[model samples]
Target chain A: MQTESKSPLELEQCLKCSICTAVCPVMNNTDAYPGPKQCGPDAERYRMKDIRFFDESALKKCLNCKRCEVACPHGVKVAELIQTARRDMSQHGPGLREIMLANTDIMGSLATLVAPIANFATGLQLSKEVLHATVGIDHRRTFPKYAGTKFETWYHRHAAQNQGQFKHQVAYFHGCYVNFNYPKLGQDLVHVMNAFGYGVQLLEKEKCCGVALMANNMYNQAKKQGQVNIDSMRKALQGGVETIVTTSSSCTLNMREDYPTMLGIDQKDVKEHLGLAVRFISRLLDEGNVKLVWKEGFKKHVCYHTACHMARLGWNVYTLNILRQIPGLELDILEQNCCGISGTYGFKKENYELSQKIGSTLFNDIEATNAEAVVTECETCKWQIEMSTSLPVINPISLLAEALDLEATQKANIR
Target chain B: MKYNTVIIGGGLTGLVSGIQLQEQGQRVCIISFGQTLLHFSSGSFSGEESNTDVQALLKNAGIATVAGGYRLTPLGELRPAALTLEGYYHSETAELKEKSFAIVRLPKYLGLPIEFLQDTLTAQGREVSIITPDEVVGCPAEVILVPACKAGYDLKKTYGKRVSLIAALPPSIPGQHIHAKLQQYFQKIGGTYINGDKVVRSTLQTDEKGVRVQSVETQNLGDELIVADHYILASGSFQSEGLQSNYDHVWEPVFGVDTNAPEDRTAWTALDFFEDQPYQHIGVLTDEAGHALVEGRPVSNLYPAGHILGALRTDIQNLNDALRIAKNL
Candidate 1:
C-alpha cells in the first residue's frame, strides 16, 4: 500500500519565493541537483499533473536536511514534497547500496561480532575501492568503526547492575550509530543519567530510525522501521517508562516529527508517546532535573558544531545550556552550517567532494577557533567533523561523562 | 535553560539586540520560528534622518551603510530607502534627477517587465532606453539599471557608480545576504540561536509585585520550558504572525498581551488603499519601558520591539527601538 501524501495544500502555499533555494545547503554547494524550490513545490505541481515527469536521481540528491522547509515563510513542506516525489519515483525498488545503508541495524549487528577485522578491512584503501566498485560506497571516505561490543550487550552486562536503584526511569533509544559504531557514547549517557539518579533502560526492541532509508528513497522500508520502533517505544511506555530519550539528535527528530509526518503513523497515543522522547542530556539539563557535580579543574576549550538535525529540532539551546553548566569548560559555538555529511549522503562516491565543499566553511571556522575539542550531538556530525578537522570530535554526553565524578557514583552504587 | 535575555524572533531587531546584549556579557538566546521577514526585506532601512546612533551601531557590527536616499524599484520608479548596504546604488550619490539612464533587460529574465519599467521612468521625466545586456558594450547612456542577478559580481566595478540595481521583490538575494551576515554576527558574539521553534504559549508568574513571565513553551520539545530573566517580543507584525487576528478581534497569541487596536472591525482598514490603515497599527500595547501590557498593566520583564509595537514601519524603526531598549536593559 502506498503511504498517504501529507498535504497538497502545503504545496500550493509556495509563492516561488526562492527562499528555500537561498537556504538549501545542497543547492548552495552543487549545480547538478536543482534546488528545493524547483524539485519540491515547482516539480510537485508537474508531478500532480503527470507523474511521469518526476526525476528520481535528481530528487535523490536532496539531503532531506529540512533547512528548506524551515526557510519557507509560507509554511510549505518543501522537503516533504521532494521526499514524496522520490518515494513515488522509487516505487520499483532501490539499489543494493541503498538497501544496505537503510538496514543499518542488520549490517551493524553482523559487523559488531567481528568488529576489529571489519574495522580494519573497511579502513583499508584497496578494500574501500573493491567495496566502491561492487557496492557503490565511496572509496575515499572512511566508514565509522564498529564497536567491539554493542551498547545493548554492554548495558546488559555492566550498566544494568544499578537499574532499579532510581525512581525516575527513562527508556534510552540509543540509535544505530551508538548501538554499533560508538557504544561508548551510549555508556557515557548511562553514566551521566545514573549520576543524576535516573535509571536508563534500553528499549526492548528498537530498529534503525530510517533517516538513511528515507534519504535514499526507500520510503516504504523506512516506514516499516518507523512502525517497529514506534511499537517498541509504545510497549516501553506501557511498562511505566516516564519518558523516552535518545542520544542522537537525528533519532530524536525522527521519532518526534518524521514518524507521523513522513511515515504516516497517525495514531494519537503513539504520537503522544513519541513526543515524550527527548535528546537525553539536553532535556535533563533544560528541565533542571539533573544535578551535576563537575570534577574541579576539568578545563577544556571546546567548539560546538550544531548538527543540522539538532538545529532543525530546536534543541541546540538546550545543548548549549547544558554545556555551560560544566565548570571550567569554555565553549565557542561555531557558526551554523551543514557539516554536509548528512548521514550517508557524504558516504557515496558522487557526493564525497560536494559534501567536503559544503562543510568547508564549518571546517575553516573550527580551525580558526583552534579549539582543543569539538563537541556535537549527532554521531554522523561527530564523524564528519573529526574527519574534516584534526581535532577530536565528541558528543556532549562524553564531555559530561568525563567531568562527572564517576568515583562518587560508584560509591553511591555500592550502597 | 535560563538566559539573561530571551529574544522571541531572529529578525533584524532580535538578532541585533541579542548581539548587543551578548557583547555586553549577557547570556542571550533567540527563539526563532523560521525564515523571518528579513528574507523579504529590500536590503535597506529607512526612517527619520536623526537616527545616526543606530546606523553607527550597524556599522560597528560590520554592516556598511550609506546615507538614506532613494533607490530605483523593479518598475524603474524611485522609492525611498535609507541606510542601504555599501554595494547598492543610492540616488543620494547617483544624482539621477535629470539623467538619461538605460535599463539593461536580460534575455528571458522573469523579473520585472521592461515595458512597465520604461513607462514608469518615462512618466518620471527621465529619458529611458531599454537594451539587452550585450548591447551595453557601447551604450551612450552614462547610467544603467540592471536586475540584482549577478550573485557576487559588482556591476559598479565594470559600469562604475553610474550602474545601479533595480530592487528585486521578496526572497531577494541581497536580503538573504544581509540576513545571513546579521545571523553570523549574532552567533560570533556568543548569542545562542534556536531556530525552527515557535513560541507557543508563555508561563506567567504572579506575586505581590504583579505578574512577570516565568518561561515560554515551544511547539517542539514537549514540556521543556525556556526560561529567561527578560524577554523581547520582536516576533514581527501580522505578516510574520507576531499579531494574530480573527474576524472579531486581534490578539498577541503567545503571551495573550493586550493589543492597541480599535475593537470595531470596520475601523481596521482605511477607505483609501494607499493611506495609512488602522489594521497596520494593531499590535501589542507597550508602556514607556517597552514592556507589553496585560489588560492595562505592564508585564515588568517582558519588552516589545520591532513590528510587534504596531504601525511602525519595521525597516525604519526596528533597529532604533531594539538598540534603545537593549541599552536600557
Candidate 2:
C-alpha cells in the first residue's frame, strides 16, 4: 500500500460549515456520525489531540451523500475526502472491519459457497446484530435481501440473446453487489441498453471496486480495487468502445471521483477514457442518441429519489430530465437528503434505525407525491426505497428497457 | 425648487454624470424609481462582438473609436476614458482607465460572479475597463434588480452568498426576497442596509454645492426626501420608471430632461431573435463635454443616463459603457 505523503492537507478550507450537515439526511437521522462538519474538519482538528485510537466509526456513517460538496462554499471535495478517510482509518487501524471491508473477493467466494446460510442469517436479527457489532455497522438501516441467483448466471441462462431487439454493444460493469445479488437488474440493464441501441457485453472478469473496504476503513485495499477497475476500463478503451455504463451510483462515483485521486490511476489517456466510461445508466438513456419506442397511453407519475452520490455528481438532473422528457411519463423531482443506506452499514443491525430515520424525510416526500412508483438511478437507493416503501422502486434504465419493446407494440396495434 | 442639474434613473450612467456635474460644483439631483443593474451585475465591460461584421456595424454607428475603427485587430480595444465624444465633454477620468477589461462567456448553470469576473478581467487586460453582461443574457444595465429570465429563482436562492446588501427600495416589492436574502447575509456579516426610502428631488445641500436629492411623496407609506449635493441613480429602465419612455419622447424621470433618443420604437428591435440583438448601441446622446443632449441642445443639470438614454437600444450590452458614461457624468 502506497501512503499518500501529505494527506492532502485534510480539507482545511472546510470552515466547519453546518450547511452540509443541515442538508445531510444521515446526520439528521443518526447520531452514529456527528454530521458532516464534525466528521470532516471539525473531527479532523482533534486528530492532533494525541487521542488514543481514532473512533473511525464516524467515517462509516457517511452514505457518501454529496450534499456537503454541493453546499460547500469553497467547493471542498467532501465525498472524496470521506471515502479516502474511510480507507485511511480502516487500513491504519487494525480490526475485523478491516478484514471484512478489505477482503471482498474472499467474501464473494464465501458468499457463493454459503449463499443459503447467508440469506438465512440476513433474515435473523441475532445474526444481523452480531455482524453490526463485529463490523461497526449501525444496526438500524435495512438492506436488500440478496437474490439467490447472481446476475451473470441468470444473464447467461435467461437472456443471452440476439432477441432481434438489442442493437448496439455496451460495456456493462456489474458492480460486485449487482453481480452477486441483483443479477437480474444487471440483465434488465443490458436488456434496456440493448433496447436503446446497445448490445450488452458483460465484462464478466471485472472484480470488486473496494468500496466496501473503503467504507470499512481499508484505504489500501480500496485503492487496489480502484486500480483494478481502472485497468478494466482502460482495456475497454483500447477496444474502441466509448460508453461504460453501470447500475451502481457509488461504483461510478468511486471509479469517477475516487480512482484517479486515491490510486493515482488513470493517466491522461486513461483519464479521458475513464471520463467516457464513467457514465451512470440513466445518462446513457438520456443522451438523445438512442430512440426509445414510446409505450402509447402508458401513464405513471414518477417521483425520483435523488441518490446522494448521483446528486453530488450532478447526474440526478440528467436522470430527472430524461425521465420527464419520456413520452408517456410524468416526473416529480424529490431532492431530499441521504436515504440513510450507507451501503452495507444499513444491513448491520445498529445503523438500521438511523437509516430509516434519515430516509424518513424522503419517505414522506415520496408518499406526498403519491407517485405510482419511486424511480432512482442507484441500485442501492432502489433497494433501500423498495424495502422502506412497498411501492416498486425501479432503476430508470429498467423502466426505459420495458418501454422499448417494438414488436409487442406492433402486435398490440395489430390486435 | 428646481435644481441646477436634474439627472434621472439611479443607474451607473446617471450616478457618474451626477458625480461629474457635482464635482464641477454645479447643483445636481438624480431621481430614480427602483433598483439598479449594479446589484445583479457581473461587472466586466466589453465592446467586442463575435462577428467582425458586428464590430463594423458598431463603427458605422459612430460608437467605435478604436485604432482599427470597427475592424478590431488583436490589439484593437476601446479606451473609454481616453475617448472624448464629439470633441467636448470631459468629466473626470474613469478609475478603469488604467485597467483593460477582458470579455468572458459564463456557463448556463454557473454564473460569472460579478466580483470574480471583474477581478479576473482587470488582471488580464490593459488599463481602462468596462465590462457588461453580453447580449446572450439580455440583461440591461439599469438600476432595477429582477429575477434573470432563464433562472429567475436560481439567483434568488443565492441572494447574498458572497456580497452584502447596502439598501433596498419599496421593501415590500416582490423583489424583496432578493433584498431580504442579501440583507440577511449582509447584516449577519455586519453590512449596513437601508430600506423604504426614495430620492425624489436633488440639489446642492452643501456650500461647496454638490448634488443634493430630496425624497418625494408617493402613494407608498413612510417615504421621506433625501437631500444630498451628489446622487447616484441606480433606478432601472422604463419598466421601473428609471427613465420614462413615451410615443413622443424619452425622458429621465425626476429631471424632465429630454433624451436624445430615437423617435420611434421600431429602432428598439435590433434583430428579431433575442440572441443576435445589438440594441445596446441606441442610447441618450451626450455633448463632447458629456452633457445630456437633445437635438443639439444640452439639458442643463439633467443627465439622461442608463436605459433612459436613446442611443443604446439595449441596456444590458456592457457595464463598461455605463461606467464610462458614469465617469463622464
Best by DockQ: 1
Query: What is the C-alpha local distance difference test score of each model?
Result: 0.79, 0.50
A99: Cα error in model 1, Å:
0.8
Candidate 2, which segments miss by more than 4 Å at Cα? A1-12, A15-17, A29-34, A42-63, A82-94, A101-109, A112-117, A129-143, A157-168, A271-288, A406-415, B1-329
lDDT for model 1, please: 0.79
Off by over 4 Å in 1: A1-16, A162-167, A266-290, A408-415, B23-26, B69-80, B91-94, B97-150, B153-169, B188-190, B204-214, B246-249, B258-278, B287-301, B311-314
Local accuracy of candidate 1 as per-residue lDDT tens digits, A9-37: 38866767687887888887777889999
Best by lDDT: 1
RMSD each, Å: 4.7, 23.5
User: What lDDT score is found at residue A153 in candidate 1?
Assistant: 89
Docking category of candidate 2: incorrect
- Chain A of candidate 2 gets a TM-score of 0.81
